[model samples]
Target: MMKEPTIENFLEFEKKYKCNSIKVEGMPIWSLYRYEIHNEIKKQTVGRTAEGSEPPINKKDLLTMALNALKPFNYRNVDVLFVCDGRRSKNADTGVYENIYLDEISKKFNSVILEQPENRKHSTPNGMDNVYFTDRVAFKTNLAVKLSTKFNTPKRKRYEAGVRAAFTDIFKAIKEEFGPDITDKMVDEMVDRMYYYEITKKYCGKILDKAQPKLIVELCYYLINNFAMSELGKERGIPTAEYAHGFAFPTHTPMQFNPEERISVLPDYHLTYSKSQEDEVHFPDNVKLVPVGFPFFERERDRYKAKYPREEKTIVFISALAEGEQISKMAAEVSEALGDEYRVIYKLHPKEFGYYKERFPWLANSKVEVIDNSENHMFRYLAESGTIVCTRTAALQEGIGFGCRVILLNFGDTALNLKTLIEKENIPLVDTAEEITDLIKNNKAAFVNPNGMYEPNAIENLTRFISEIMMN
Candidate 1:
């Protein structure tokens, strides 16, 4: 049997091969390819992988992007440039997409540009001033690069040579480590990304030149566009920050980088949701981890608490697509053991909603009510439930803030990811439904104080940090 693919094994390979040292045209190409290589290795080794589908560019989204681009906004010399994905949730009351991470801080800045790639059905305009789109810019840049490759220009020659050098180094490392069986597939992935990186560089460079923003803030820094923007910001002496969107575990490869490498593909600052996250992953030495608190959780917790009064007999189980089977089975068993005394809500992750019934057939027979809507945020469920159950999810961390009793399912990465909370001994960990039943029936689990993890006045702290960075 072949050895199981693990992040530790891949990390070791990266260190031994000195993958981070590989570069093309002064940009760290290996960092951009690391995630791709990791996924490919897992797919070949395990015969399966979880790769999400990238929605194709439709006529409506393109039209929305065109309209957003035409809106008049001074893109020059802005205080900040905020970029986020278009897959946002529409605010029921306001009827506009909400950028949970940057909205509050965006209001603080006198001059800022809120840019998005393209509009999705779930995530449309936030009706805010100074909002624009960059899909057309990326489209044109990528198309131009594809059309201009036939000419034997000096710039094209330099690009080709640099790419060849980087590819040779990476292929040599992979061949040395894993042999030639998987080398071609991995190389093909890297080649595809090299072209994408060019698009990202030109797209980001154009936006930066036009805006000349004092600071750049982005969500989900691992995106190639955001990574390119960070490098561009460093080149221009402008600072870039990323809002940490999810929990970082030891298994997360994209967050880890060689501390010794001088060129960083990541943002200068990583704005985290809480102070406790610092202990989760070891990042590059220069990328500062700042705990700015999570205004979305804080705000939603209060709003949901007011809207839905807490029920002492309600239990909510947070589901993750990666661990869907194990988590759903546990939730079903617990529901059976509880015997209708408590109301159980199994909240499915957005990705799980489409095939959850077919994937987890037992859910249909289970007594628990499953919530599977994008608009119904998880924080709302956490606020009303007396107990929150989960294996692996950032929602477990947020559940701590809602003052709900958290029961962790000790399967796979759940215990590993939430190691700190487990060590604190305030939350209980159980492998079987009986253990969960006993804890909930007896009300034996203790709740941790939220302030220990999340800092207060999140928006104020974030805006203050932005101001300080702009001044320097």
Candidate 2:
């Protein structure tokens, strides 16, 4: 087994793979896992992390876990195909990797099996490659079903029903939204689903073709959307681990599904961010919950320099998906309510800044100032601002580290209630702009630093765990 992992150690490790018997002949020992490792290694730098322009994760620590997983396998031949899990596969692997480490890491890797980001475009584009590229895996057996064999009239009878059922589900959703009548809404929904269905169908044969897998590692991404990768991994009886890219069982997501379904779809090992996070989820006996603390939050807490005792007039609202417009509107309303003394600095998520600008053209005219998100770190906003309001976002979790007095906004209704899971002492769920205004106006909210949610040696714990699993 390896000790401290570095590119040099990895290169040295590859030297043992000179024998022909141990050489993985057909597929490059499935490079997807290595690609994830490469990305995690890249994550361990200063001012850089997982998602765009926010807090950083200790991804280099995660790369350590990845490297450690290889300790037990003293293989002689190292030809591997590091596949990308498309874009949606981005998530928490083992809790080992975080932003502080990931901050300075670069995009390139110095290994033969590892792949780069552009390699994904070549490997899994929406065009013909979405199915399967033979360079990665090309095999067929009576037990395995191929997409090409079932592409036509009677040959594809089993698949046609599934396609029809999907369309039916889309139409049902349309009916739910647009009332009991058929209209253009249903047509649009159907057309969109049909287009995707046809496109995705091409990938099935390519994905399902028989191929030997030494081990299957799902980047632990959107399993429902990208089930092919996970499903193929399971069907092949390969040892698979799902890296919890983010909250594996968030209040808003897989946690809402049936335990049986989640368990069935989940990888053999379900990695988590922390013990506090893992304790909340009741994963099945088959799924081991490996809790590695949040690397970004931990590192920040250690190095955090407070910027408090400043001007109290500015209010920063951390934005989330689908709630940007609502929060922005409320910021404007609150600014108008509180008059010129108080201003709402709406920190828009980087991805939706353009959309919000186009949606609210009067943004410049109002007291609400949309923060130039690039200019400052989110923790700065939490420290300097008066009150923080947000929808379901990682920012809220980070808020706990900064002693942020947060209010969870009830944006649009969904089955997921973020507060039920992410319970902290300071946060109170708010449903209206008036409630938020009252909190700010009355000075009812107080920011207090919480104790001990982060573990100091998370990287070590995660590395030990992944190594033990792979070693067995």
Per-candidate TM vs. native? 0.85, 0.56
- For residues 173-287, could you state the per-residue lDDT of candidate 2 as single tens digits? 3234322333333333333333333333234324334233344444443332233444445565645555454543232323222233222234566566667666446444566
Instruction: Give per-residue lDDT, candidate 2, residue 343.
Output: 59
Instruction: Give the Cα error of residue 208 in candidate 1, in Å.
Output: 1.5
Q: Cα deviation in Å at residue 45, candidate 2?
A: 45
Candidate 2 RMSD computed on C-alpha atoms after optimal superposition onto the true structure: 16.0
- Report every candidate's CA lDDT: 0.73, 0.44
Candidate 1: where are CA atoms >4 Å away? 1-9, 24-27, 43-51, 55-74, 111-122, 137-181, 444-446
